[model samples]
Target: MTFPLRWLWWLPVLLLLQACSSIPTLPVAPTTTPVAGVQGMASYYGARHHGRKTASGERFNQNALTAAHRTLPFGTRVRVTNLNNQKSVVVRINDRGPYAKGRIIDLSAEAARELNMIRAGVAKVRVERLE
Candidate 1:
């Protein structure tokens, strides 16, 4: 059965309304700057992930002082200090993860070793963005 042509006009209006409904009302994230002395938990990437391409498009090196942050831009250098032993390491942001609750950064395996946290697997850390 065929409907009357009058319904054609209503069809376009309905589609327009549907499209407008699909638009997000707010942004998923907000504009922000990296805060100095952000404190949180830090972990490390293991040997299994070495040589993999990171989110920043660099090959992951277990021995290099590199790190992953949730929001820091790639190539941004930061000093990660372990609160337990007061050890610190400078690492460049080369990825984005930890994928763990309450974790702020993910360090390279070597960085973890330098921090004396490889055995513990995680540490309370203070992250200071470098200029």
Candidate 2:
């Protein structure tokens, strides 16, 4: 009986040791720097998604100067340039992503219009992180 009780106590100690060993000593933080010359398809969302709660919990405003970026942290400012018309607009990221596979950014309706991309629905643009 005493032998069994001793083994039970050691069992818990062994399990505790195993758990501690499994934990990583250090965790890595994700780097948020934007790659230079990153180009991709950009699109806009408007009345359909306006007034809805965004992932950041802010009310989505179609007229606001905001954008969605895949990897840029929220509050990052970027300059988006329309390659076709050479028009550019500065937008702040307030949301998580464009959600489309190949898209790197999603602009508000007004931003799209500013870039002269309202008709195309999608445009090839260059996104540069504003310092």
- Each model's lDDT comes to 0.91, 0.89
**Clash count per candidate:** 0, 0
- At residue 26, candidate 2 shows an lDDT of 83
Error of 2 at 23 (Å): 14
> Which pairs in model 1 have colliding backbones?
none
**lDDT digits (tens) for residues 18-128 of candidate 2:** 888865578766577667668889999999999998777899999999998877878889999999998999999998778888898999999999999999999999999
Error of 1 at 63 (Å): 0.5
Query: What local lDDT score does residue 96 receive in model 2, on the 0 to 100 scale?
Result: 78
Per-residue C-alpha lDDT of model 1 across residues 22-119, encoded as one tens digit per residue? 65586555444467899999999979999999998889999999998888889999999999999999999999887999999999999999999999
TM for candidate 2 is 0.75
lDDT of 1: 0.91
* Model 1 misplaced stretches (Cα beyond 4 Å): 1-32
